[model samples]
Target chain A: MTQVHYDKIALIGIGLIGSSLARMIRKAGLAGSITIASRSGHTLAAAKALDLGDHYTTDNAEAVRDADLVIVSVPVGASGQVAEDIAAALKPGSTVTDVGSTKASVIRQMQPHMPSHVQFIPGHPIAGTEQSGPEAGFAELFAGRWCILTPLPDADPDAVARLTRFWEACGSRVDQMDPEHHDMVLAIVSHLPHIIAYNIVGTADDLEMVTESEVIKYSASGFRDFTRLAASDPTMWRDVCLHNKDAILEMLARFSEDLASLQRMIRWGDGDKLFELFTRTRHVRRSIIEAGQDVAVPNFGRNVQAPTDSAKPD
Target chain B: MTQVHYDKIALIGIGLIGSSLARMIRKAGLAGSITIASRSGHTLAAAKALDLGDHYTTDNAEAVRDADLVIVSVPVGASGQVAEDIAAALKPGSTVTDVGSTKASVIRQMQPHMPSHVQFIPGHPIAGTEQSGPEAGFAELFAGRWCILTPLPDADPDAVARLTRFWEACGSRVDQMDPEHHDMVLAIVSHLPHIIAYNIVGTADDLEMVTESEVIKYSASGFRDFTRLAASDPTMWRDVCLHNKDAILEMLARFSEDLASLQRMIRWGDGDKLFELFTRTRHVRRSIIEAGQDVAVPNFGRNVQAPTDSAKPD
Candidate 1:
């Protein structure tokens, strides 16, 4: 199982996730050859400049021809078009999967176009930074992260096992879950936080009394943390909003309702209610740290930049 | 200017900020003697064990006796009580200030009780981590942080200058603002973020559809960023909400209104609006980095904890 290798691996998008996968495949020598393709010529040029794959092309079909594995890393909205583009070119018995955040939507978008001989397995690797594009990825992006697969009931077990070994070799732990459950889980953990972050940042920007300079100058207190997630890839997040509408909307509604109650508690001076909620939230952070999902560092241990003149003694 | 010194310094709360002040005074030899006091005996004992001050006391009045500088670092809700407790013992011509997050409330609670002979200037040092208590502080905690002072119009210029020198010795740049304006600025930059974090964490915890374990497992995607702020001391946050009520409520209302609009955009599938908002927020994060307020580390450069078995392959 450790010796599993793909004769050729075709990556359908050369953004952060796709480029990271290409780097990991090369680092582990898991693919005999790697082909990279992207819709943007500039991104394809960057991937080539980075020497990320054995073959690079703008044509999705050309990239997947004769490939044993095809991984679509585009926004979920683009998954259908890419699936249609590459379906005819996928070699017999090749396994097709994705690294989109929403698994159920990806399956729905891609499964119809897939050939009978090809296996389509939808997956999401629960890892990323706020950055995007080919230059933002690294070989270690998946190290110690989770790669969750939501395989169709009829997906060939042999193909699934082969892909599992591939992710494991890239230093990710693999798990299986139903696509619907994965969507719900991600909505709470991933989608809602980004939406909230974006909303709050937009609100801050629109405040007439509070100058943007003041917000930027004093952001270290707490606001800066939200800015990181709010600054995530807009195109990707927009696709996520469209593709996983039900779960995302459900989580958003719940989040807004909770916020209204909290606002009321504040308006009424209910210190006890506020304290109770704040105390309980600390446990979630502790559990995540214990679960090895995050490190227990103050401000994630970012090396703070030296104080500017304004923050220094005159 | 570097030769400025206090004959005696009293720290009237041995939590993270107060203990950090004690350490800085000791490290810089800025005070001939230091007294540390806390209502909680355990915290006072922790300060004593750490040798953070030359003296330790449970009596707030006793700690303030003959002190040339008295810095109250208690929760905002307790500022008035502490002022009342320490008023009689405050030495003539001594300076009394606070390190509370809310300036107007601190000034309101503390100013009336201060004798005319002693200068009562409200201050807030905008530096801290999620951790609390004496053991969580370090001498370097304020090395590159901002300390805002909201002095009364009648406050003596000499007294304000002396306290400014003290904060400089602690390695903080000091800025002066009106107490009300300070409260408003902090409401947008600090209090609202913490409130949002606590609210979301609470919502995720109370979810029936998603389990806490799943939230913890996938938190690295985005939820964990909020958790750090949510993990901050509950009592402190509770007091912040209660003391800075008007400003916090105003910010919360604005945040909620903006969120509702964002929710509508998502519901109506306005992908362009979503992308535009997300793209705009990125500029805030970039400005913060360029302003030397935060580093540009991706995901704050958290060292991935070595994967536990579940995140590792068999």
Candidate 2:
């Protein structure tokens, strides 16, 4: 047993990231009980059937009643609503956090609704797959990922430390940052990437020049990467785009302007400019791999002895 | 052991695809003698040191003198030069092909230089990772990929069939299309994706609103996918862009128009339109996965392993 860090932890979203957290917490023995809640009855039933939590309910408030830690893992647009709903029900001194992609917007939406009785630390686990829902989760998902926490000035240090320990037990390396910096960083990294993915995929779909079948067939070329990004959760991404509008637009402007310059290079047949940009970008992939973000396939399945799930090379 | 399909095979330009083919042919025992040839002395020496072939030389003409099959796997722009160099030395009636991305361009560049007695068939295997060089390959890289042949109307069928069988033996499914159609199809699927990836990564790098560090650290969200494509072989991709200009610009116009429409949707908070477009896109990913083009990963291995090379996580 990994050992329980909390007697009761309530998960408020029960979607992909939320469900993954629930599974990991269960597998890691980080919680004595997990109370699952979502706005959808169908999702609640599915989580109940999956045995994703020790307790399941469609009532967000009811889920957090006696919970020691409440994690709100919903779309950014719904964070405020969830915070309001569970504000009165949260136990005194309970640690409250979230796993939303955008931190500044999340804190702005959630912190005001939260009662001072609870510690509201905004967080994001920079990890996930295109798949969503409670059934689409596994315990090993967070084994080596980073989880950033953005806690308010008034937040209790002891509560933050405890939550840090809790995430550590769940296989996350925790880092604390100010909410504004977190928002700006993610605006460039996570939020901008999704917007561009959606944009490019939409671009291809609307094209009359290329058939959809052709796009999918030869996708191994490069277009397929955008499809994975494009396949992300519609509701969740819609909310993120709406919530992080300024930062996203700023990043988008930068992206578009940069693209214009590169396009000029192609138009002018500037191979040297193209070569320089291409060569510089290669170092980033190297850094990502060195930082343990990538595991080349030749080394895959080496230590993995028949994983219990369907994520192999079959 | 796989049956030896040819007595001798000469490979010109042992980069990513060329080196990969050499390895695959060796592993499958399809070539009695594998001759590796490239203009770069460093690479030829490296290929020889890696034992990638039975014969290694820097001269393309010298390498093809006695080979039954000649595979020119250089950047598309270099195809004409290689063809011109090897035209006299090729054994007449021997089959010759290329692994360039642009088909019409390759045919135009290589056809006049070839001996009519030699069956010159143009082929492109729609398979590769972002990495290049002889060491950056594996025998299974072509497994389950599509190998496209764009043969001239007067090209011999026997040669086409032989090349198709060779690709199949190397674990690929073969398809034939007109050179013009191949160029058009690939413009959307492969060329545009790489261009956009290069463009967007350039965008992120030059963004005044977000630091380069921010772009690098938060890449897991969606931007990293673009990075892999941006990090692709510049010379190969630059040639692809330059050679396939008309098709790429057509696709680009469609993409830009579609992106404008989607941008308007986001600007007006048209959730219904946004939701509809986003929802329709998800099926594309499913279709690709069903077609065995993409695989899902728990995370992008910083926290998870990338199940595939080009595509990034949510």
Candidate 3:
């Protein structure tokens, strides 16, 4: 069992990431108790039904009172309100962090309300599935994944180290980055991909000539991969798009510029150029596999039997 | 076991689709004998090593000499050449089919060289993984997937029925579509998704702000899904882009237009627009799952334990 890092941990927004944290903390014995909070009475009752926390309340302030660690796991757009709701109730010397995708905006939203005696560190665990809600989370969600923390300067070093240890105990490897840099990196690697997926799925849905049934029937050809991301929580993603506007716009602009060039290459039947780009992008997947970011098996090992022979020809 | 549908089945190209057909035919006892052929001696040797056929040859013509069915699975750009190479040696009353992605282009490329005595039917199995080459195929690759055939006006009815039975025996549901319609549908469902995936991966690779390692490290956030399609056989995708130029261009234009509007929504903080699009697309994925085109489990059931409860919230 992991060492108890907090006497009472308060979890805000008991959705996928939040409930997953509660599960991990309980499974690892990292907290004496977990106080689950959500603005929605339905969500709070659901968390209670799931037995995900030792205590539950609809009032954020009531949940955070006397809690040593407060974790906010709401949509980025709601981070500031959640912070303001819980700020006056947070225990002195507690550490407050979040699991939002965008770091800079989350920091901007939550930092102003944090008490001077408490440590407010903005964090993003680079983990999740398209599924969300209290019932959709598991203790293993954070295993083998990277959790990035963007702690502000002048934050207590002990508090930062303690929160880092908390994430480590939850099966995440932790890293610190400037919040702005974290936002930019995540904009390219996460936000842009999700937005692109949503856009493409939307495009397919809007096509008149290509019937929706045909698209679904033939989706295994390639389109189904994008659907997983497109099916993610709409509120979470919408907030992300609104919160990280500049970085997302910059990435989207770059993506559209590159796509325009690619479209031109297709228009001109520039086989060499298309081949070059396709080939170069291949090495990135390989690198990702080698880094243990993804399974190397084919089709993400989905439903197909493993091949008996080598994958390479020569 | 499936009834023997052909005296001998000759497979040309010996790549992912070709080798998969070889394995399925062998497992289901659909052919009296099998002949594997490829232009590359290395691929031929790999097929032989897998014992994928009764006979193997590097000469496409030699393999098809006495075969009742000749299945060409080469890249679309090479379809014309393979047809020309094997046209004279094809047995009389035999059926010639292909597994090229773009049916119209494959028909245009191979039709002129076809012999009137033999039936030529262009087909595409909407099944594959990112892995390629002879060794990457398995018998289950086409199970429960769709196989589309676009036959010419003068094609023999008996030959078309036989080919349909052949695909069904190999565990695929068969659909007949006009070659032009097939190309258009595939452009939106298959080709455009792949092109967009490759384009996004390329954009990420070209980024100076986000290091490659960072992208790889945090890929599971969303970028990894695109990498799977982007890592697909480069040669085949390059040929697909070159051959299905017009339909692909049209789809790309539609996609780019939608993306531009979505970008404006983000820039203007139009959460309602974003939320509407995002919510509408979620139903498509649910429809896809309900249609049995994709798995209902989260993350494509990739390495995660099953959730214990319902996915929906009250």
Q: Model 1: residues >4 Å from true position, as ranges?
A: A303-314, B303-314
Q: Per the 3 Å backbone cut-off, how many clashing residue pairs does candidate 2 have?
A: 2
* TM, every model: 0.96, 0.91, 0.96
In terms of DockQ, which candidate is strongest?
Answer: 1
Q: For all the models shown, what interface RMSD does each have? A: 3.1, 7.2, 6.9
Worst 10 residues of 1 chain A by lDDT: A303-312
Question: lDDT (CA) for every model shown?
Answer: 0.88, 0.79, 0.89
TM-score of 3: 0.96
> How many clashing pairs in candidate 1?
0
Rank by DockQ, highest first.
1, 3, 2
Residue range A199-255, candidate 2, lDDT tens digits: 777777766756887777788777777887788899998887777767766776676
Docking class of 1: medium
Q: Output the lDDT of residue A65, model 1.
A: 94
| Candidate 2 vs candidate 3, TM-score winner | 3
Q: Residues A1-314, candidate 1, lDDT per residue (tens digit)?
A: 44468889999999889998888788777889999999899999999999999998999999999999898999899999999999898898889989999988888888999989899989898889999999998777788788899999998888899888888887887899999999999999999999999998998899888889888877878999999999899999999998889998899889889988998988999999988888889888899999988887666775233333332333
